[model samples]
Target: MRRVLAALAAGAFLVTASACGSSGDSTGSDKASSSGGTTKVKVGVIPIVDVAPLYLGQEKGFFKKQGLELEVSLAQGGAAIVPAVASGQYQFGFSNSTSLMIAQSNNVPVKVVSNGIASTGVQGKDFGALTVKGDSSIKSADQVEGKKVAINTLKNINETAVRESVRKAGGDPDKVKFVELAFDQMPAALDSGQIDAAMVVEPALATVKSQGAREIASPLVDVAPDLTVAMYFTSTSYEQRNAAVVKRFQAAVAESLAYADAHPDEARQIVTTYTKIPAAVLAKVTLPAWPAEPDRASLDALQKLGQDDGLFKTAPDLDKLLP
Candidate 1:
């Protein structure tokens, strides 16, 4: 979540805002040809709870309903996706607003067409957490001051949310030293006393605790109420050129999202088919509520946070970014 462009999917799952030097325009074009009216699209994804709705969409044949023959691929990170989507290597990408805002500053022709998940009270409890070794002296956010903190990625969702959480708990986030590490390495790092706290997500949150890490606090839904934690984004050009196709996909996705929200266990089962995480770990993992539509205010706040964090130089034009 290590601030690197490339990473393992379910293990360390990093998503940074860094750029990838790939030749291409912001206009998206499908690399693979589709027979007749079928439009084949390459979609970049990451195996995480945020992407559950996409699994639901594919399982329910939402893409097929839209005449989109989608080939989903795991992205190295959120940064690699801009070029992948822009070069037509991928028609769309699954990313959080943290990377989206950063890409917008670079004039990336991408727009979040739909919402994936929003932090709704306890519903998104397992979305993210800050942890310390169970035997460590640190028991609260205040103990993290002047301490070493690890995050999967810097200046992205994990760190930003952790920073806000620390501030909310009357701690100076600036006083802590930040380091980038994989999600899986957190438990070992904490046990080795290499880091005082680590911001992690999913099975790793549960895994870290099982390794004797205690949760000091979690920012999943507590830091920002109903925040748009995940979304499906496509290049603006793709949306413009394939208006009817996009609408069809959106409609079908809306249906699948509602279905997944109603039948979470079924949704989780479908996700396990593609992800490397075990079913037992997945069973206890906190899944998010699949929202049917993107929240305008939550998205705006995310973009604002990017600007505030200096991840973006200018405010992104939401009209061009959102559906």
Candidate 2:
């Protein structure tokens, strides 16, 4: 995953190069092809609980109502999706706020269009958590000092959240050894004592809980109340050339988010269509908040954390990045 993120950071240059070419018109046409009054667009997404609203929205005919047809492409993570969207392979992509900030700071041509997911702002009940084994000596984030901790990606949102957790618990985050492990693989790794703790989100969080993992902290909530964890975004070039389509998409997604947030059962059911999570585990999954509008204050708090952590090349210009 580290190698993948490194590749993604390096691929930012490819996006910059592509943005400089005369392919904008052609790419825009390919991105939103209209036929019989319907615009077909490809979206790159991670097959996780956070993206359940998009599948639900499609099933609920929200996109269809906007005359938009979605071709959803599943990827490993935002690292892969960001570059694909910027290179014009996908019209839009879903990614965590930090990854998007990193891209924008590096001058990658991307613009956030709509909110994706947010922390529920309730400790021990949030969708994501910092967990240790059932019988581990570590009972709080402060105890994680000098221990091996796992995050999905190094120097990304999860890492930032975990560090904040440690700091809030009065521990020096720098003293904690961080490791990169995918969400799916974390359950077994934690069970087998491969790592002392893991920062995980649903349905993996549910799986970890099923294995008797003890939740020590809700790291995302610790970062800020209702932290805007992720958002749906498009390349700047695509947004520039396809304003009408982007507007339609933003509206459709906002409607989708409201519908899913209002109907949690439907959201959980939709996760089955894209992911292989079990029925029992799916029931145990905690759904994230899906507000129609991004929380600017929460984003500001997150940006400050990222800046202090040196996660960006230059501070992201939220005025230009936000819709």
Candidate 3:
């Protein structure tokens, strides 16, 4: 079965991460109080594992403490999110670094406000990987050269990370062919020999691995470990108009990240609650690192990867995107 995150990423529908209005944090001042009582911040989000912190933040009352209502407006992909934030339809959004970079390259003015998920760095612990059928002869990234590789999307994080891994493995990145396939379909494609290998993310990675697929490389980690997969962002105008509100939101998110790292079991439960992943599978899923802030070095490497891949005409100003 397809993961809820994947389903949501394909235009499912909106579900508010926050509950009904609640009392403010009495001990602490609500920074968003300046917005007149409470602020409703709608964000375009995908229900993937990477976004667990957002849901956890809601459950922990982090956003409520800031007097902000974080409404999770589900969009199919980051392709849909950029325009929504740019048009002022949403106050914030969650998108991969590459997509946001592409938007900024087009001068969309969306700035990343905080970090989302980061790679685990340890092999077999990260959420993304290059995998082959369990019986395949492919033993390393080097073997993937001249082979057909499947990725959820082309010219995005998956391809970029896989390309980096191929290069690191002393293989010609150009020799590989890439085809797009939905995450859930990739395992079958691998099993049926439709694709030689696949660059997959979590829940799907968990899915494929459980189906006897073997991971030969962790591209996201190999290229840049603890890589920030996605982030919360908003238009530059919105950031300027709500500087205090933005700071408060970031603070709440940072708290949530720390909370998640400190409470792995509860974090897993929160993820299950929002995503509805199978209990058995959820227990085995590899959770991502939630850094309080975006890793600058990783972002730089990601931007450079895009530039090298010719996805961007010029390297984006990384500093401009950070909060």
Off by over 4 Å in 2: 1-30
Query: How does model 1 fare in lDDT?
Result: 0.69
The sequence of per-residue lDDT tens digits that candidate 2 reaches over residues 1-323 is 33444567464434333433433443633357789999999887777799999999999999999999998876656766787787677899899999888888877888999999999999999999999999999999999999999987778898999999999999998899999777788899999999999998898899999989999999999999999999999988888888999999999999999999999999999998987788988899999999888899999999999999999878999998888
Which candidate tops TM-score? Answer: 2
Query: Which regions of candidate 3 fall more than 4 Å away from where they truly are?
Result: 1-36
Model 2 Cα RMSD, 1 decimal: 5.0
**Off by more than 4 A, model 1:** 1-32, 184-188, 191-194
User: Residue by residue across 1-323, what tens digits does model 1's lDDT show?
Assistant: 12222231223222322222232432335444568888776677765666766777777787777777876776434655655665556777877767777666667667887777777546226557888888888877767888999986667776777776777789887787888876666768888899888987765676676677788877655446678777778777778887776676677667778888998888777767765666667767776667777777776766665666677657777776777
Summed backbone clashes in each candidate are 5, 0, 0
TM-score of 1: 0.83
TM-scores, each model vs. reference: 0.83, 0.90, 0.83
Which of the numbered candidates is closest to the native, going by highest lDDT? 2
- lDDT agreement of model 2 with the native: 0.86
lDDT of each: 0.69, 0.86, 0.76
